[model samples]
Every structure is written in C-alpha cells, then in structure tokens.
Target chain A: MTDPVVKATALRKCYGDLCAVDGVDFEIGRGECFGLLGPNGAGKTTTVKMLTCALPVTGGDLTVEGLSVKEDPRAIKYLLGVCPQEVNLDPDFSVVKNLVVYSRYYDIPRAEAEKRAAELIARFHLHDKLERPVEDLSGGMKKRLLLARALINRPRLLVLDEPTTGLDPQSRRQIWQEVRDMKKNGLTTLLTTHYIEEAELLCDRLVIMDNGRIIEQGTPRQLIEKHLPGGGNLEDVFLKLTGKHLRDE
Target chain B: MNNSLAGSLSYRAWYMWRRNVDVSLVTWKTNVLPPLLEPVLYILAFGFGLGAYVQQISYAGRAWDYLAFMAPGMVAVGVMFHSVFDTMYGAFVRLRYQKTFDALITTPLSPEDILAGEILSGATKGLFAGAAILLVVTLFGLAQYPSSLLILPLSALAGLLFASFGLYFAALAPYIDNLNLPVFLFINPMFLFSGTFFPLDGLPAWVRLLAELLPLTHLVNITRAATLGLLSPSLGWDLLYLVLLTPAVAWLAIAKMKARLIK
Candidate 1:
C-alpha cells in the first residue's frame, strides 16, 4: 500500500496495574477499511482510543498520516471523524445545530459548515428532522445523524467504535450501507467491533485481538480459508481462535 | 509540546466557549432572570429592611449608610455565584452526564482548550450577573459614575478567579453530590465573612486575616471602593491579589482537569 493512512508500531496503553492495550501493531492504507475484531476486554476499544488521541499512549508510538500521535495529536484529530460508542449528541441542540456546532471545533467557517451540514442532512435522509432536538429523534435517526456529524469535518480517516452495536437489523443495515458508500468515495476507516458479519462484509483487511494482542491479521476471506481449511466463515475462525467462553464472565 | 501548558491552548478555546454561549442563548430567559431580579430581592431584604435597624456603617474610614456599603458587596457576591456555580455544577453536568468533554476531545480541541473555554464561559456569566447587579445598584443611586464603571472589568477578573476555584473542585469531585462540599464549606463562609454583610475589622485579628485570604474578600474590597467612589491606594493590594491569583489558579485548574480527563 502507498503511504498508509494510519500506522501503529507496538502501540500500548495501561491503567495503573492494568494494561488494557498491550503492544499491538497494524497499518491501514488510504481508502481501506480496517477492522479490529475482539471480545470485551480484548483491548479493541483501548487501541482505538489511543489511535484517536482520546487516551494517551503509555508505550510505543502511533502515527496518522505520518504525524506522530505523541507529537501532533491536534493535527491528527483534525483529520479524524470519530463516532464514539455512546450516543453523545448534544441533547439540547437540534439535529442541524448539533452538526453546525461540532463544525466550529475544526474552525470550519459557519457558511461552509451550514452548506456541508445541509448536504450531509440530505444524504442521511435527516432533512425532515432538521429542526427536531436530538433527543426527539428515533434510535436509527440518531445513529444516522451521528454519521452525518462525523462526516461534517470532511475527515481523511473515520474512526467508528461500535457504530451499530445496539441497533436493530434495519438500522444496522442502513449504517452498513453508509459505510459502503463512504468506502466507494475512498474514505479510509478504522472500525472496532465483535460482530463477525459486520467485519467480514465491510473490512478490506482485519485483525483479531485477544488479551491485548493481535492474534490474527489478514483479509476476511484469507483468514476464513486459512483457519477453517474446509467450510466456515469469519465467525467460526474467530470462535476457534478466541474460544467460546463469554469474555465478560 | 502537546503536554506543555503553553502548547495545549489555542484559539479553538473560543469555539468551546461559543458552544456554551449557544446553549445559554436557547435558555436566555431563565439565564437572565436570576441576575436581573436577585439583586432587587437582596436589596429589599438586606439593604432596606435590615438597613433600617443598622442605619450607618463605617467603611474605607467614612460613615456610609448600610445600603450604600452593601450594594457593592452584592456585585462581588453576584460574580462569585455566577462564576463558581456555572463551572462547578454546569461543568460537572457537561463532563459526567452529557459527555460533552468526550465529544470535544474527539475533535481538534485539547483538554486545556476545553477547560479554558469552560472557565472563560464561567467568567462571562459572572460578568453578566455582576453587570446586572451594578445596574440595579446604580438605579438605587448607590453607585457613583466613572469610578463605578471600573467594576465591570473587575467583575471579569474576580470571575476568572472564582471560576478557576470551581473548575478545580469539579476536577476533584468524584460524584455530582460531592460538589456541595465546596459550596457549603468554601463558598458559604466566603459569602458571609468576606465583608459582604459587615466590616471584617470588628472581628478578631486572626478572623480578619482569614477573611483576607478568601478571594471574595479582595473582590469585595475593590468593588466596594469602585461603587462608593472611595478608590484608595490600599485597594491596589486587593487588585494585585486577584490579578496574581487568577492565572495561577486557572493554570492549576486546567492541569488538574487534564490529569483527570486525558488519562
């Protein structure tokens, strides 16, 4: 790949005695969707947090677009559009206001912000809910608005943390369709989720993480073919490698 | 550079401040009502009703009526309440329940930028409330002209000091209820003992010294001087105290918040 959009060399994060993301490495090329697949406590979110500069790196180094996260996090953040795991939309703001106010953080001009907000609103089919408060929107609309807000900055890299974790099938498929469209537009994305189907369908290349380490990394089909040998999907490959015991238990 | 104090801040701080301003605008009626009306109530209860019993008070070495003496104190108190409460309760809600800070960090804003914005917004609220009280006092003919105008800027400075104090407590608070500790223990004492209701000179030597340590005491001193047109060279010390202490506390507040949020 020419000039990877994201590169991590032994990235690590620790909370006192607990090391959440042990040394892990991966790279995502421009226009590629990379997946970090893992169970709860397997450090997928931790690694993502470090990549997004929300959490400090305890050891190792990470660079986005060749700028070190330790050195130029603000610059890296400018290039990132993050949709957090939780719905953090400003409940007091209408859907349009939420997008416009968020655009100010990037120093985007108000007129430009409004124009981009209008475009994203139409794309996400949230034009009808333009004046409605975020709290008033349905679950699916909230998720779609979040995606619209994330795209407002015209970020080079999109970081999604469980974008469709609790959504219904219809909502999840809508999100999947947006991701697919973003991929077609050559927007590089880094996604972390345990849903094997989501990872298999969207990710161009992926890594399976467990106990703060990358246990496997390859194209979804390559991993399935190599791990299963005969006839199984990425889910079977994941279960076989990471074990079926419930992670939270 | 990212971790250093100087490097962590930028013009982006204003955007965070603007975000709060936008929210306040939506609730502008509720936001304006307290500052506009609270002074009138306090003036009736304390300045008129209680002033009748205690007619004259000595301040800045002049015999002044009780209403005139306490009017400036009201402005100081307004500054304290608006700045401290906004940063303490309002900021705590945004930080913990709303996850506003989480959302901000995802963008180009640093933790310092966020805290600076919060403190700035808190100071702006203090200025608004103080100005409102200043208007009320002027209407009562208690505040003198040109000299009293100084209170507007003084309110901003005191606002910064109090806002920093509130933000520090917010960083230390583990739960929303724990914010009450500073209010009851720190702010309540300052409100009563900061020469708002009476002169601190009558108190014991140590008590006066202790009151002097409270930021609001100094704020009251300068504001009282400004409102009464009794500006004195001695008031320079009070101004110095607030000016010196605000930046130190603001730096510490931002550092503490960064330690709490950026881990």
Candidate 2:
C-alpha cells in the first residue's frame, strides 16, 4: 500500500503533569474519511493541533505527507488545512476579503487568489454574502466561511475540530454534504466530533478515544455490531465504549 | 543571522501588515482622523497657547522659538502613542477577542512573523501619525530646517521600539484590564516626564536620571536634535540604543507571545 496520508506511531502529547494524548497509533489512507471520536478533553483537539503543527508534539512519531513535523513544520503546514472549534474569523474583513487574505498567506498571487476565491465563494454558497462583514454573517455562514478559508491553500489533508458543534441541523447537514463532496473528490479528512451521528455519517473509519486512549477502532457498522450486540447507531456504541458520565465537570 | 532567527522572520510578514492596512482603511475616518488631529491639537494647546507665555529657548546648542522646540517633541510623542496603542490595544483585540492571531498561525506564517508584522503595522501607524504632524508643523512654518525630514525614519524606528514594548506588555497581560496598568503607570508617566512638554535638563537630577532610562527620552532626543538640524555625537548613541533595543525587545516579545499562543 502507498504510505498513509497520515501515520502516527505511539503518538503522544503532554502538558506538564497532565498527558493529553497517550500512546495512540493510527494510519489514515488517502481519500479516506477518518474520525477521532472523543468526549471533551479527550485529546481530540490536542491531536489535531499536533498534526497541523499548531502545537508541538511532546513525543512519538508523527508524519504528514511523508514529511517529519519536527524537522520541517512549514512543509507540513503547507499540506494541511484546519478548521478549529472556535470561529476565529477575522471580523475586520469582509467575507470575500477573509478568503483573499487567507489565500495570500500561502503566497497565492492576486489574480489566482481572486479566481480561486470566487470559485470557493460560489462553491460554499457565499456569493450573496461576498461584500458583507464577517460579523454580519450567521453562525452557520461563519462556519462555511471557515471551511472555505481552510480550502484556500488546496490542502492534501483537511482536519476539522467539531465543525458543526453549534450549527443548526440544516447547517450541519449542509457541511456534511460539503465534506461528502470533498471526500468524493478524493480529499483526505480527519474529523473530531462528539456527535456520534456526525462521525457515523461522515467517517469511513474511526477510533473512539477517551482520556487520551483509543479504546476501539473499526468501521462504523463494525463498531456498532461489536460494541452493541443489539445493534444500534454510533451514539449507542459510543456510550457503550466511552460511557455516559457527565464530562462537563 | 542564525537559522532560527531567519526561520522566524520572513517576507510573509508583509501579508500580516497588509491585513492591518486593509482593515484600517475600511474605517479610515475613525482611525485616521485622531492621529492626524492629535499633534495639531497639542500644537494649538501648547505650542501656541503656552508658547505665548514662554520666551525663545536655547536648546540642542541653538536658539529656537518654543513652538519649534515643541514641534519635534510632539512628533516623537505622537509616534510613541501611535505605536503603543496600535500594538497594545489593537494586538490585544486581535489576540484575545478576534482570535485573528490564531487564524494567522494556522497559515504558513510563524509566530515570529506575526509578531514582526504586528510591530511593522504599529510602526507604520506611528510613521503616518508622525508624518501628519510634521506636515502640519511644516505648513505652520514651525519646522525651519529641511533636515527635519529625517524625522520620518526616526519616527519609524521609534515606532518599532515602542511597538516592541507594547507587544511585551501584551504577551504578559492576563486580562484586558491588566493593560490599563502599563498605560497609567508606565506610558502616562513616560509621556509627562520624557522631556516632551518641557526640557528634562531643568528637572531634578533623579528625575532627569529616570527620564534618561525611558525609551521615549532617547527617541525625543533624536527627534528634537534631528528636527533642529542639531546632529551631535550623542545622536549616534540614541540611534544605536533604538537600533539595538528593537530586536532585543522583539525577541522577548516573540518568545513570550509564542509561549502564550502555542500550547
């Protein structure tokens, strides 16, 4: 097999006395939709941060596109797009300007950036909101804009951290559709979400994590059958594996 | 430059600076007017209002009208305030509230590049404000010597110096309210005691000693001397101090900001 788009061997991240991601191993193939399913503080965000080079990896071997993150992070950044849990949009910019300014960070030329931005704006159904300030857009529109901004670099790996946490059902489905379309176009995606339905619908292969450890890994159907013999959706399997404790505290 | 420093800074910083200009231009009416008007207001209140009572003063080894002496000082003060406010409050908004810094970091830009871009943007604001004051003073016939034009670059350097200081404060500030401490305690006192409104030579020895320790004092000295066509040997030291202090403070700002930004 061609090398997985992402490969992590005993991947780990630690914060002082606390270990966020501990001894997890995974490989994500090209064009496959991989999900890291976990409750809050389950090291999902930390794993994504390490993968995107936003946070340094404390230990273990991790590589994206066959490039070592520790040796040349800039090269790795070029190949990955991240949609953070927070909106983090530049409110000072207009909808189109946000995309354009983001495109510039990758050193895309003005003419090409404009063309690419126009394509993305149209694809994301943001044509009408082009001239509007980012603050004026709804939460869903902000999420869509964030997705488009992530695509500006035309990355090889797309990492989404709770992409639909706050969105309404319609918006969430719309984003799901977008992710499905991107997957059909052969884009590799690594998504982290607590919503088992989102993981079941979007992830081709997934790992259920709790407290920095991956307890199970399989196809959604296999996980549902293996964990819940009665056979239920991912939410049942998720509860079976991760428990229904109140994680908010 | 070592590989680490070289890696930290890049031409990508220009994109960060351009981002600021794009947003500032959208609200130019609110953003541009204050900086342009502030020095003129100072000139009116102090240069004309107070100069009427004060006689011509001998400063920098030459005699000039009080307005002339005060104009350069006002320009320096304008640069200082512009850079500090632009970087401190503006950067805090981007870092904490807007989360723009988080967005930028995801891109190919490094933390150092972001910090450098912020410093450049702050310095550019200072330069524009200083230039506006220079133009207003020149139009009023207060700035006599053509050599005063050198104040433009000097102001830019001072902007970098003050912006680095602002970023240092920003990196350490835990909450937005913590920012008020520096403005009230450090910046305001620096403004009053940095030989801007009056000559430091006339102040007490200890006070003068404290003034010399302030960055604005060196900037003011450079601006006043450069504007009055009074280049002296000590001017080199002033330039050298700002030149050396900028990168040192920037290095500190970058390290602190990295720790705060990168988890």
- Per prediction, fnat is 0.73, 0.61
Please report, as a residue range, the 10-residue window in candidate 1 chain A with the lowest summed lDDT: A127-136
**Model 1: residues with Cα > 4 Å off, grouped in runs:** none
Comparing to the true complex, what docking class would candidate 2 get? medium
iRMSD (Å), candidate 1? 1.1
lDDT tens string, model 2, B82-147?
A: 999888989998999999898887788887788899999999999988898888878887665767
Task: State the local distance difference test value for candidate 2.
Answer: 0.87
- Which regions in candidate 2 have their CA more than 4 angstroms from the true location? B1-3, B61-63
Cα error of candidate 2 at position A67, Å? 0.8
Candidate 2 positional error at B52, Å: 2.8
List per-prediction Cα lDDT, in the order shown: 0.91, 0.87
DockQ of 1: 0.75
